[model samples]
Target: MITFCKYALCFAMSIKKNNIRLLQNQSYSWLFAISLLVFSSLSYGQDTSVSQENDANKPVIKDDFEWQIILDLSLIYGPTIIAGIEQEKLSEYLMPGLLVDISYKGFYLQSNQRRSHVLLGGTELGYQLFIEENWQLDLILKAYMQGYDSESLIEYGGGDAELLAGLKEREVTIGAAIRYSQYFEDALFRIDFAYGSSGEDENENHVGGLIIDSFYSYLLPYKNWDIYLGAGLSYFSQDIINYYIGVSPDEVLATRPEYDAEAGFRAQAEIYAQYPVSESWSFHTGITHSYFSNNVKESPLVDTNQTTQVTLGVMYVF
Candidate 1:
């Protein structure tokens, strides 16, 4: 535990300059998370047994939190999608994210296509609405897609500044979501229905959009490597489309004509590999590709029809 705290402080001191990140080929995030939970539980059980046996002999330290923290420092390479992002790009991949695995009851943020910040212990603020043997439902507060704006563009991909000069900044949001997860022997299927609100429209009206994501992931039980394959489709509503990538008449320029985005779909495919070097160290890498539909491609604010993310990194588990 002392060693773990040292690692935690080390991670914090270098959080911004750190280059490694977890390659969430959409599935490996949960895959590694689950593995950490299993190992943590086993460790805690052993500790508890020893404490019980020595109860009368000595004072045993009671550990309140039995959790695993992983530092995934990845060097990611990917294409730029949103305009005005080149100025914001610090490296090849804009930025890396840190993930925490705490043993708390809540709905995990399933698959949100939009790029958002990873909130520490963010998945803990959820209540289980229903639970069965392999299926469960939860109402959760999670980081939702902030629509397309400067921040997401900078981190995920970058582009020309002039092209997006006149665009409105979409605010980031954490909204409510209903998630359903199904577990199988070697796979997991999840669906999320979420809503995000950034701001009011030009008509002084508040508006929000609905997003539905369906994700399926399977794990290959390779003795030497942890391999995950994932595919998913995210459906965006018209309001969400326009809020993020669409154009309105008030904000249209001569070069960028007014265009309303039709509700459309974004498809993603991911493959990831993780190899454990020892009990606490491992090397991991993966690639994720998401293709935007014509509705999104047609947006003047966006310059690319697809985004590809690739990462090579090392993970330290304590």
Candidate 2:
């Protein structure tokens, strides 16, 4: 009976050991499977995240086309002079104008007619190549026409009598331009550069140079309104300035022979508010300040000093 008892004890211990081994193997198998599943899921989630991030980085494309038309009128309210004659009081600076713009796929065609004492008109074809969501390069081809009165002519002495005799009151300009625009959530900023040629008479040769312009606009958060401020600067060579501001040598000799009229620099500033009635139309009002340099202002035939103007108009955006 004692021997039988001992054998029973040995068998029981053996069974317990086998059960332990089995449980250990089962636990290891479960752990391996769980680890593999977790790793696979983690890898999948990482891939999905990367894909979504790449898609989010892509730019939004606008495929629709739009058109806008604008009309403007303004008055010169302060002491102002057109060419050289000083008009002491508020006079009619009839600035009746139209602007048309058509845009498609980030490209635009623009045409404008503006009179501010001088009849000015221009046409431009431009393309916007976006660098990012809020930045773009604008390439443009522009042609402009500006007309001045006969009194605005700067007299030049005896160059070619025939050529001088045929000089007309109109000056026409054609130019090409490039501009950069940076857009913010509530504002936009831009800088532009241009080169152009102008001519009045058949004998007059066209000259071209740098034209710089810049503007900043801020949108008021409360209302359907925007405030815009801008300035422009232009530089032309002596040849170009002489073409426009030149006085006749004979006239110079008779008057102030020491005065040399030539193209220099011009600067102007404008501040405006636009209140939108709808998505397509708006009421616009602004103040403009124009200053001519000593070279331009000193011309006896031209009023080049500081001049201020108030303008009110309507604009449409498509």
Candidate 3:
């Protein structure tokens, strides 16, 4: 009887260890897969030249020597978890930002401060690589931060009460993207492929990821109102999913077990309206809803599978 009990215990232990190993290997495989996808997508149109043989006579907007500057102020509210903590509700913030653009010939230097990944606001620096009538490619560097403060497990009275603090810090990534845009009578379609990786996060965690985005929008003009309706779809790579949502062995506690996050997808819809109040000022309001995938929603850190964001702001052009 004693021998049988011991054997049973050993078998259970072996099974648990095997499961953890399997998850680790799968995460690594996903990382490799996204890397391959990024490389292939960047090389897709490298050798071919887009022909303008018959369209050369078409008029092009050559604002080559122009410098565009804009200042914006807004109130934004949303919750996004970089790693699970219950205090993400406090992360909502106000944004006062600036945008500057200068172009010479077809090349441009641009900088914009705005909300980026997970609703975290930051600055983006980019250089236009190839620009034409309908397509453009850029090399970009972006700064990202989850928030200044992280959530503590004690804030939520659960089995995770003993878990450590979950504060995340800022990191930066460098990447490239190719974007194509087409306009019809009153609607426009845009699609882009972007991939980036950061060396180490504030928590010393490795982070890298890829995203593909497609958007369709329509503009309707009524009196002094410009209404915009837009829908977007984005694919998030497994590496990124794991970094933000997965729980590793070191992070696992009694209540949080190891989780392996697969690639996920997001669908979003938004409606925005802009009304000119003066020659230099405009008032805008927009609301957006984003739905997360199962892979991300299944994470122990995630409390909700969907997020809704609303913004009311004013912009001034200089």
- Name the best candidate (by TM-score): 1
True-vs-predicted CA distance for residue 181, candidate 3, Å: 2.1
Better of 2 and 3 by lDDT: 3
What's the distance in Å from true for residue 3, model 2? 99
The TM-score values for the models, in the order shown, are 0.69, 0.59, 0.64
List candidate 1 segments past 4 Å from native.
1-65, 83-94, 105-125, 146-158
Compared with the true structure, the alpha-carbon lDDT of candidate 1 equals 0.53
Residue-level lDDT of model 2, residues 194-261, one tens digit each, is 77566643354455555554545444433333455555554555554554556545444333333455
lDDT of each: 0.53, 0.45, 0.49
Error of 3 at 32 (Å): 52
Better of 1 and 3 by TM-score: 1
The count of residue-pair clashes in candidate 2 stands at 11
Report the C-alpha lDDT of model 1 over 22-49, residue by residue, as the tens digit: 3224235544553564354333322111
